[model samples]
Target: MNSALTPDAVVAAERWTAHNYHPLPVVISEAEGAWVTDIDGNRYLDCLAGYSALNFGHRHPQLIAAAHAQLDRLTLTSRAFVHDQFAEFCHRLADLTGQDLVLPMNTGAEAVETAIKVARKWGYRVKGVKPGQAKIIVAADNFHGRTTTIVSFSTDPDAHDDYGPYTPGFQIVPYGNLSAIAEAIDQNTVAVLLEPIQGEAGVVVPPAGYLTGVSRLCSENDVLFLADEIQSGLGRTGETFAVDYEGVQPDMHILGKALGGGIVPVSAVAARRDVLGVLQPGQHGSTFGGNPLACAVGIEVIKLLEKGEYQQRSAELGQRLHAGLETLVGQGITALRGRGLWAGVDIDPAVMTGRRASEALMERGILAKDTHGATLRLAPPLVITADEIDYALDQLKAVLG
Candidate 1:
């Protein structure tokens, strides 16, 4: 902004917005694969990849085609009426998640809220918990979404503060600590919700066997395990799901972000019939939950996942990414945490703040974002090649140097 007249789009956005997000001043106009071109016609490698929402990359040909075809046929029919594309996406998604049923929603936060409602109902009718006393345990530092209920359990001051009177019934526990979760679960507990890898918490991966222990503890306590895979899922973590690394399937799989294949906003909670089935017809519904356009794009997303190329690429290319990143440890980076194409890089505070590092990287033709105080979250599109990864690493090295 200081070097040039701030782009009109960026200026207008700042002039009209609520200032909720402090995004770096870069106005992207178009994108494909792993790159985006600004309105000024400068292309930068898209390192954030829309926080894993672009796992399949921007305007994926197949997904675009599906959206186009569906747009020509039908767009929104609401959940009141069933569209031809609805059941296909739901069924395929259920199959992919290996769940008995799938309930679609428009955003990840909606899916989380749906899961919370279903879990509470299940506790009342199925688990036989006291109607008003049903309790759920969540990890500290978890980022499910910014909804009021979800924010109630959020430990981050930015998301949690000013968002009260907070919802009750959620018990906070230390993430990755099986002992903490076990001690928190009581007879009135209905579920334990977690993100296998705490994406917003700087791609925080838990200790080994932590997920398995949580799964076992939930099973022993007759509690439902809800895994929020909205960010670390859909082939972003070098696996279909980060929990896949441990082969631990939660009772409910909360999915979104990449499920729309960067085409539309789509999300869903995949769970066995008994758990999600607790919702009565009038109890839960979304007008745009399973609309034709979303389902069409979602179906193509599932189809692309079924072939397994993206997951394989994440697994194989991830090594190259991390290996190069690891070399920067002492040079400027303090540490790294993540799996697959996703990473949370901690820049040495003595060297530079994450914001400064991000700006430096941006100036060098790479666009990565910062999270916490000094951590950078990088999730490049899965389609990025070896050379692109190397280029990003080289730029990062220069920025840190």
Candidate 2:
């Protein structure tokens, strides 16, 4: 075992906390860029990137500076009263997304809930859908969030089982099927909520032109296209938004994760004024939604994205990463799927389970996560270099061998 993999710490953590997460054995103490050091000072390359939350890398200098500067100033003020940092954050994010308004929230799930509320309200008020009859079509195998309403439509048994009585008014359709989405829509269908690229479902990218078709259908049917970009946005897929690759824009963009620059929890729903304006005063609000600290970190994140360097890096490096992973197919990898710096690799079940492959990689100083049965999800920080990518591939090859 690696010196950094502390058995005692892992045991203590499991004993103290709920069994909500089955984390790897290593105990990370500090992280910088795409690397982490455990308690024993053993280092490992971070391939998960906190599920794309660390797109700019851990403890980025500018993000840290913004956090520190905000610490000396202000933090929370709730939605009851406005704060100095609120407008700039909202405006810049709106500009970045090319939307008219923004509703800030603290987490990805909260933003999703906010979108649901806004969509339902818009359906009732604008689309003239009967109250309590507004329906939103969602994709199967989707991983929106763990909220009661969000998980109600989840096709995954692990996420759906025991989560209800479950919320209603959602229609489930197979992802990447435009015909299913079109067939599911009706007079009462308010929106089609989907992840442009299903992140947690092993970074599954939908069929080409599917998003464009969805956009056109939504426009024709007067239904909203709400894209949950929480995990796939912010330079992860080499674009500002995953839908951008298809030249498709959703009615509302639900954003999170990297929006906080890995410094704080920040998320928002960006949409046109008419769509989000359905919510009047007292309709929805959050205490820490647009707090100064979150805005500070978010502003820096937007600024970094505005430069377009990280997106370019993800595009260029992503090609190299995918090329390398592609060469591994039939050797140990059964399949590979993804874009930019994100990939879901299927290890041959004959060789080992995904969890076993992850453990082997961990022992080799590369940290990654396994999903499903034999699929590994790799999303390294955008700051990782070409040499680091080659090193990780070498380690993976050794583990599979």
TM-score of 1: 0.98
Angstrom error at residue 307, model 1? 0.9
After TM-score superposition, the amount by which residue 311's alpha carbon in candidate 1 deviates from its true location, in angstroms, is 0.4
Q: What is the Cα-based TM-score of model 2?
A: 0.99
Per-residue lDDT of candidate 2, residues 67-153 (tens digit): 999999998878888989999999999999999999999999999999999999999999999889999999999998999998999
Q: Estimate TM-scores for all models.
A: 0.98, 0.99
Name model 2 segments beyond 4 Å from true: 1-5
Instruction: For each candidate in the order shown, give its overall lDDT on alpha carbons.
Output: 0.93, 0.95
Clashing pairs in 2: none
